[model samples]
Target: MITYQLSKPVEHGGHTYQNLSFRAPETGDLIAAEQFKGQISQTVAMLAMMSDVPLPAFKRVPLRELYQIMELTKDFLGNALATTGD
Candidate 1:
């Protein structure tokens, strides 16, 4: 398991946020990016569903789209890590 810590509080609108974090489990031999992406996407989708938000109309969701989402997630994680570097 890969764990990262926040060095500073996340702030918005002049207020500090707490407990904001991300975690990714590293498998034994393979870092399957697609699997991570799918996990994130499904989690988001589930949250949206719980909140009664309508999902987008995609004729066919492809693996490429999932990969793209994963890449975006990786970039986001990288930025967060950089901001809270040790």
Candidate 2:
């Protein structure tokens, strides 16, 4: 597993969180990514499924941070680039 520490903690509503970790993709993760067509949903789901994080956690992340994390892990086994916008 590869672990990444967020530059700063993220705040959503009244909660704050830090750090994210994910492992290399397995066959199941790939299959799930294939099943989702929406770019954002698919990306977040892929990340959540591959990582220790839950889906709600990704939803709480700021867009810039989310993009950075996804880009940083783009070539990672479980983290595919599924962006629809720049």
Candidate 3:
């Protein structure tokens, strides 16, 4: 299990929303948490594909870059959710 924290409020179309946050059992830096990060990264990518948001340009970027983009996406989605009152 991986833990994620929302850095911004999620809001969409004048509504608020919330996103998932959990603590993982493994202990390591984000870079070292490959499995956990991979799961989150995949989830983010899927969501981006299904949403209005444009996907990232590079598909083979490093995990660190993916992690950063995922965090931003998570925050954006969280804010959208918050705004939608989800």
Question: Which candidate tops lDDT?
Answer: 2
Q: Any runs in candidate 2 off by more than 4 Å, and if so which?
A: 7-16, 77-86
Instruction: Please list the C-alpha lDDT of all candidates, in the order they appear.
Output: 0.33, 0.69, 0.39
Candidate 2, poorest ten consecutive residues by summed lDDT: 77-86
Give the range where candidate 3 is weakest over 10 consecutive residues by summed lDDT.
24-33
Measured with C-alpha atoms, the lDDT of residue 30 in candidate 3 is 31
lDDT of 2 at 4: 64
lDDT of 1 by residue, 11-61 (tens): 444544332232342332123222224544543343223222233411122
Comparing 2 and 3 on lDDT, the stronger one: 2
Cα misplacement distance, residue 55 of candidate 1 (Å): 2.2
TM-score of 3: 0.28
| Descending-lDDT candidate ranking | 2, 3, 1
Better of 2 and 3 by TM-score: 2
Candidate 3 residue spans exceeding 4 A from truth: 1-38, 47-58, 79-86
In candidate 2, what are the lDDT values of residues 1-86, reduced to their tens digit?
66667777766556566878878777677677667667777777778787756667767777887788777777784334433323
Residue 12 CA displacement from its true place in model 1, Å: 33
